[model samples]
Target: MADLKDQRHPQYMGDRQIVTDLLGTTQPSDRNLADLARLCIRYRGFQGARDIQADLLKVLAQWHLTEEQLYAKTREIHTTAKVFATHNDGRDDWA
Candidate 1:
């Protein structure tokens, strides 16, 4: 498996950087964590996007949020993010 922190998908260059920079910080603000949660849902079901998936989950854990809680946030993300809203399909059932 690729190192989650070391691998970045080209498709999400700018989006990944935003999340990565947030992760690099020791204490991300709630708003930043909300951004991470939105991004986490945004990448759901994408192939070769495990790095971002794992990274998002890792940060949630680091901040002491459960996976269930992280996923719960996905529904709101799906409702709000245009990408997730428009991309709904079998691949995005996680939300």
Candidate 2:
């Protein structure tokens, strides 16, 4: 076991390309992730997905938009998925 300070912080976990490529389906690429997020907002009737898209747009317009934006956006979508998943499972918890 390694000390917390000596352990790897996984700086690459948030990388857009890696997440996108690793998923290799819903998002095989960063651009695809962004596009899918947008499409979810445009088509999906899920409020969570819509909110995720909104958050993504806000982050993107911050002058640092890039492939990373897509990754970040997808994570946001995942949050939505979690929320809906819980709700569907008969739980009303969400913030």
Q: After best superposition, candidate 2 residue 31: deviation in angstroms? A: 0.5
Question: Tens digit of lDDT per residue, candidate 1, span 1-95?
Answer: 86545334555776768768877877765456567776766776666667778888778777777757755755555566643234545463333
Q: Assess each prediction's global lDDT (C-alpha) against the native.
A: 0.65, 0.43
Alpha carbon deviation, residue 74, candidate 2 (Å)? 4.5
Worst 10 residues of 2 by lDDT: 6-15
Candidate 2 matches the true fold with a TM-score of: 0.23
Model 2 Cα lDDT, one tens digit per residue, 72-93: 8778766665422224565432
Give the lDDT of residue 10 in candidate 1.
58
The best candidate by TM-score is 1
